[model samples]
Target: MGSCEVYPQTIQHSPNGRFVVVCGDGEYIIYTAMALRNKSYGSAQEFVWAHDSSQYAIREGNSVVKIFKNFKEKKTFKPGFGADCIFGGFLLGVRSNSGLAFYGWETSDLIRRVEILPKHIFWSDSGELVCIATEESFFVLRFLMERVTTAQESREMLTEDGIEDAFEVLGEVQEVVKTGLWVGDCFIYTSSVNRLNYYVGGEIITIAHLDRTMYLLGYIPKDDRLYLGDKELNIISYSLLLSVLEYETAVMRKDFNTADRVLPTIPLEQRTRPLSVMLFKNNCLISVLLNYLTRLSILLQFSGEQIV
Candidate 1:
């Protein structure tokens, strides 16, 4: 299928590569890759595909971001101003003029907000890291999920005061960086002149300079590869050094669920790192303790007994 529009502003393949999304002429089109059959979804200023490609979201106008599941409109909410919104795993990132806000895609719950407008934003495939670039610096934010016992508690947690208890800034680079992607603990990005650079362990390393300007399109954590698009419309993939940093970071933050999801992606040898092993054991112990405490508290409450 084809559109009568002169050209499409952007074209993207779903994570599973089963479908293609084309945006142009104020419409977003979805096409099946095999037969090339297509459908238009009307007007959208911007759109983003979920990491698994099971759903997608579109920035409608300036204030609202609408999510679609199974190609149907699922939910809509105001994520402040600006049309920059992205999704990875269960988290959604939106850029407002005031700051960058992260939300739980399923619940529409605000997770955290950073008081800065980033030039570029990228969420790690596992949703453990959020890497952002600004004119003067680069930053990474990390978060953990906690079990909330009540709807009231969850509501309180979404408030600005409680957001600090859920997320933290992992690191920042005091240098001007362009498009970037997070790979484990390292951040790979390009400079204004299209110079490839990597930041790890507080050090920035320049890798190479490309002949033409390029933008980071996406990253495949499973394959440890980055997809880049250049001005000439050429797309290229480059292999990157894989690390278990995402898993370790998640475990360190006590986000076992996310860590568990990332664990299988890591090489077995890397999984045995001392910190990883220790954190795993500690997390298990904490889980058991919390469970016991919860049960004891409930029993006491039901028995109407007072503790000394």
Candidate 2:
């Protein structure tokens, strides 16, 4: 195996397991774990792997973060006063000294900023919720990207002519619980010092209290279980059916936006099943039909259509 002499303080493997990042020696090094191909960046403080692991950003300074694609630097930006870490998705999550902020990954536009400094930050696999943990509390920030009217459309009355241009909107946040990892729709965490706690549909439940502290490693959607590590270095697994049920209920309630954000996290086999595929397709069709119906109704009313 090919290895570097430097010890890494922060390391992350890409979601696809094709690449790995090592942060140390005042540089960020990226290399394929199974091969010898690698690249490095100097004067970097922190870095984040995109969900697909194909892109990344390195913190060059307190305010500046440089993004890279395919091992090449693409763009740089000064996010704000205290931006430290970067999390990639439809938008970029920049962690600063004051709080977290969102920015357009491509346009380099500032979207929204939240003022909450956290000790630990974990973005769900689906990128739907950002789980932040502090010594005294925990927070879950939910985000959605929707199309909206552009500024140009608002100003050009003559050009508008009943047609409006649209742009992506970074959504708002909702605090679900004091602490925990958001697995699917459920929040899982260690509470009361040593007990495993989870919340589903606004209800809090304690699964067990351990003699020692346990850390949540990650979630496995295929088995609907959580992989955890204990202080003594023991690994444990726990089921979260309630959380899965919560997600399904959201879909049944026609909360397709949330459902769409979470759909990527489901197992591929399940997502490809005939019934699952049909359900998702139907959801999309319903949204399109409803939108056209709304436009048709408005047009008919303005055209003076008569009721029979």
Q: Which ranges in model 1 have alpha carbons more than 4 Å from their true place?
A: 1-6, 80-90, 147-156, 160-162, 215-229, 233-308
lDDT of 2 at 202: 37
TM-score of each: 0.66, 0.65
How far off is residue 193 in model 1, in Å? 3.8
Question: Distance (Å) between predicted and true CA of 109, model 2?
Answer: 1.2
> Candidate 1, TM-score vs. the true structure?
0.66
The lDDT for every candidate, in the order shown, is 0.66, 0.60
Output the worst ten-in-a-row residue range by lDDT, candidate 1.
268-277
Q: Given candidate 2, what's the lDDT at residue 275?
A: 26
lDDT value, residue 17 of candidate 1: 92
Tens-place lDDT per residue, model 2, 1-308, is 87765688988777788877888876777777788477555568788866666677788767788877777888988875567666655456787777766665555556566565665665665665566665566665555433222432344421212112222222222332333566665567776467777644334456676777677787776677777786689999876543344545455446766655554344433433332433454464455235434544675677574322
Error of 1 at 116 (Å): 1.3
